[model samples]
Target: MLLLFVHSKAQTVTGRIVDSEKQSVVMATIALQTLDSINICATTADADGRFVLTADSIPLPFRLIVSSIGYETVMPECASYAVGDVVLATKTNVLGDVVVKSKRPILNVQGDRIVADASSIIKGRIVTCAFDVAKYVPGILCKNDNELSLAGTMSTTVLVNGKVWNGGSVLEYLKTLPAEKVSKVELLYNASPDMHVTGAVINVVLKDNKGRELTGQVKSSYYNNHHNTFQESGSLFYTTPKWSLYSMYTFADAKSISRSQYLSHHTVGNQVYDIDVDARTHSSSLTHAVYTNATYNVSDKSNVSLSYNASFSPKSDTKGRTTNSYFSNSNYTTSGNSYMHNLHLAYVLKQLRLDANYMSYSNDGTQDMNYEKYENPTAYSYWRKQTSDRFNFSADWGFPLWKTARFSLGATYAYSKTGNRQK
Candidate 1:
């Protein structure tokens, strides 16, 4: 039978841990256990490899265990007050197949989902928004300025900090969200019921700012090709412990010229005819867009958010002329103006979310064509006007069911109306 003897006088055990090369092992774990293998005291080495642990009662012949990352565990010969330095050996990697490690891993796996640390990659770069950082995440593709595909498959919906982003198109929403405000990007392969997602999902997690603070960005660019193009954009955000506000705006003007040729051959009743045509088109467009969102944290487990978005293509005009080999010379002109507006609201309580969204779109345009053939002239004119409205509402709930499985349930409703007129 083994018995520990207790001493009346309290004592302090102090020591330093290091590697074989005498380099201090910072943050190495040390433990003192009784003979029966019960942990009595524990501490960690500081930056200089020093540690001090005090015991109210002494246990004779105590067992000491020391361990550090990337090193083999060490069992000291003694655990008395006069115990000397503990040295550990660096663990060698002899497996020749492959090895992967990172001081700070860019991607972390969390059952059914992968999280990419956006803040780490966004630093020291000109990444102003989430769109600028998505390129670095594997399996995500930027199909265009308006769509994002996953694993080369269908486009997926996007969420900001666990809430669906319905303010505008996916591309536009990503551009408005500041990259610095993002903590991580989660790729949810299996969405939960409360998420209300059909397939895969990409969720952008935002950093929690505790105090009142403001952040913003402004950028512009110009390009010269056959025609000149220019763009300007900006974003602003203000956050407090209870609420957050965000707004973003973009304006662009672009002009271009394109040329094309067509050739055709026809044979009728032993007669053959060949025709060739060439055409040139000049087009110009102007666009303006803005999005704003406000969120209120009702409690630690619940929140509410409201968002609005507006976009306008005030001027979109095209004029072109075609030359014919044997038929007629033709000229055509087209112009259109369009605008879209959206409003969204959401209430989240832990695993449950309720959302409502409304959207409207309107377009007005005209087209005219003029052609002449063999001293005969023909002219055609057409006009078009269209409008659409959409409404959606949903309620979702998600929760863990088992160790490796989750249960999700949701309900959704949608309605839309459209009107068109042409002359």
Candidate 2:
């Protein structure tokens, strides 16, 4: 019993020593080399074709080379195969598929549908919004309208932090959230569920803080076009750990500094042939945003999250125009801004998920056209507000989509209203 105890603790090599044809070769030399230089072990195969040998202090990269009469010598893992595991492929051309390894990705390996890491935009990595990120993956494209299309289909429904922004186009929402804040983008392909189907499906996965404890970054940039932008972000988290309370908080702020040239040639007149001319005009817009999310995990497989997003964009413009008719000329200037938000709570247990989402959106915009058309052109001003509430519940059921893939179905309902508070 004492000898057996020692044998179990030490690494053992037990297998058959065979010829090139896999026929048992008795009396063949089986050498086991230990890196300790002084330690080495050897044995001979039995008549029944099996051998068991024990050794102490054997080092890694142990190799077994067999040679016998009239057969080609073979090595499993070679540089040709790239199987570099020392334990499985120690010598020439030895390859073992059962061994686990890490290598350069030809495709996404695990964890969700895919993984995308942000690189510096100056390095040709342009991550402007959801469309920019979506363009990085295969089968996703950006349309002329700045909308996202996948698999030849337009309008991809998007879910951010587990709530539907449902703004027809997610380009606006994607711009509000920083690309660095996103951990993964799940391509919900051929979705049968009504709640997530727009024409295609996109789920923006945020960086989870549950196990991270703390993480975030800040960035600022300048452009050749006389524009500047800056951003700041941070996150704090505490997983249940050994106890049973989980909490996480994330926040980000961004201010966009942008400029543009608005040049137009115009013709306005009582005479059908007579025309008006134009000159140079310039416009600048600034946008600031704040977004936050708080999540609490109640138990091992249960949790709830609350999130808020608020943003505003104010634009200013200066203009001048000249009409060839009577050599008329005029100039005008104005500014406008808008805000939007989403509030939500959610729960998750196993294959079931439930959530309540409320959203408030407001926009006020104006443009001043100084010409012969209006008797008194006070900047064209418009303001609107909208509110929406939605309850969503879903459960997972396994159905075969193909021999290799499965189907997951879910549903949702929403109530909403829109109004013009100021006209």
Give per-residue CA lDDT, model 1, range 197-281, as digits (tens): 6666778888876889898888788877589999898889999999999998999899999899999998988998898999999
lDDT of 2 by residue, 83-120 (tens): 22112112233367564322211123122132333332
TM-score for model 2? 0.50
How accurate locally is residue 362 in candidate 2, as Cα lDDT from 0 to 100?
Answer: 65
In candidate 1 the C-alpha lDDT for residue 322 amounts to: 96
TM-score of each: 0.70, 0.50
lDDT of 1 at 182: 77
Tell me how many residue pairs clash in candidate 2. 8
> By lDDT, who's the top model here?
1
The predictions' CA RMSDs to the true structure, in order, are: 17.7, 20.1
Cα displacement (Å) at residue 169, model 1: 3.2
lDDT value, candidate 1, whole model: 0.76
